[model samples]
Target: MEQDVSLGLAIFVEHGREREAADFYGSAFGARQFQAHHIDGALAGVEMRLGATVIAVAGANPRREAEPSRGGPFFPKVAGGVSTIIQLTVPDIDGCFAQAIAAGATLRDEVQTDVAGRRVASLFDPFGHIWVLIERDASAGRRAA
Candidate 1:
């Protein structure tokens, strides 16, 4: 069954307040709750749909805490971090930036130009997850955020 399924991307977050985190994410990106499970008065898992992507969150598992780190080395916090970044492509950089800021995300960087002709900005959400917002030139097509 594992071989039959192709891997898509999803994020896993450990929240001291799982429901609060879920609500925040739901409000931030207009995410819709797809699935949820509760066990022992704690959230076991939740799946939310943000645009076309799926994100999963759950209470931290004590047994899985020993896994090796992943994510880019430049962001040390991202390595083995509970908060995982999810990028969004938007038509208006300034508008999206304002919305995110208003939704309780802290501005991490001012908008900057990349070599690939994209306007990009980074932000840290209320839950400490990192998100990169990208405005791509219609002419350039999609590359990387």
Candidate 2:
């Protein structure tokens, strides 16, 4: 049985950097990478599976110097700040956070845990993206927001 409609999220960055970002995510989250789309000898879109969730990465827009130009490479002309975020849940939040930092992510805030047993973190990736990582407590079913 297949559903008629499905929802998905895809993040587009610099043209040439799409594959790079996908690689980073694969390494960071221990996900398997499957090529979804490619353009100009590079990955334009990729699918990464972290556990049961699928995350997508794609090139925003690429303008070849030879191929009739379309503005100044990339589209929408995003500002310096990021507006969207990719949320993740991992077994080891600290370890994942450290690995992300080592892989060029800036710490957006200190890891905070409320007395109710909720531990979470926010970070900005070097590749023009943001992420919120949370750790699940094995003993507890849910943590307070």
Candidate 3:
């Protein structure tokens, strides 16, 4: 079998309520609920479509417990390293920023212009994931081309 080079991105969260967390992400990103399955008295998995990307959510399998003394070294105490940030390229950075803030995300930075002449803003979701929204001016594309 040929090895697949592309792998889907998943953010493993220690969620106290899986359904709520999934719904929050879905609403925040304007994503549709692709799939949600429950099994053996726990949330088995869920998939949400963010633009063309699919994000999977799964309950922490208690059966695969790690040693109590083996603390996570790479991950931050508040936000895990695995989920550094997710960037969303949109047509309206300001609009998306307003929507995300209204949906419960804290504003990390105000919309600012970059050297590339794109407007961008950074925000943090309730789940501790950072999201950077970028809006590239249409004229910039023409100049580049």
- What's the distance in Å from true for residue 143, model 2? 12
lDDT of 3 by residue, 8-40 (tens): 666555534567668777777687778887886
TM-score of 1: 0.68
Candidate 1 wrongly placed segments (more than 4 Å): 1-10, 62-85, 139-145
As a TM-score, model 3 comes out at 0.76
User: What ranking emerges by lDDT with the best candidate at the front?
Assistant: 2, 3, 1
Q: For residues 1-145, what per-residue lDDT tens digits would candidate 1 score against the true structure? A: 8767643444444535567667877766667888888888778667887776777766555445444453221222342244456688877888888877877778888888877878999887765677888995766555543
Q: Is candidate 1 or candidate 2 better by TM-score?
A: 2
Estimate the Cα RMSD of every predicted model relative to the unseen true structure. Answer: 6.0, 5.1, 3.9
Q: lDDT of each model, Cα atoms only?
A: 0.68, 0.71, 0.70
**TM-score, per-candidate, Cα-based:** 0.68, 0.73, 0.76
Lowest summed lDDT across 10 adjacent residues in model 2 is found at 71-80
Q: After superposition, how far is residue 136 of candidate 1 from its true place, in Å?
A: 3.9
**Shift in Å, residue 16, candidate 1:** 3.2
| Least accurate 10 contiguous residues by lDDT in model 3 | 72-81
User: Candidate 2 on 97-137: residue-level lDDT in tens?
Assistant: 99888877778876899566779988877675678888978
Lowest lDDT sum, 10 consecutive residues, model 1, at: 71-80
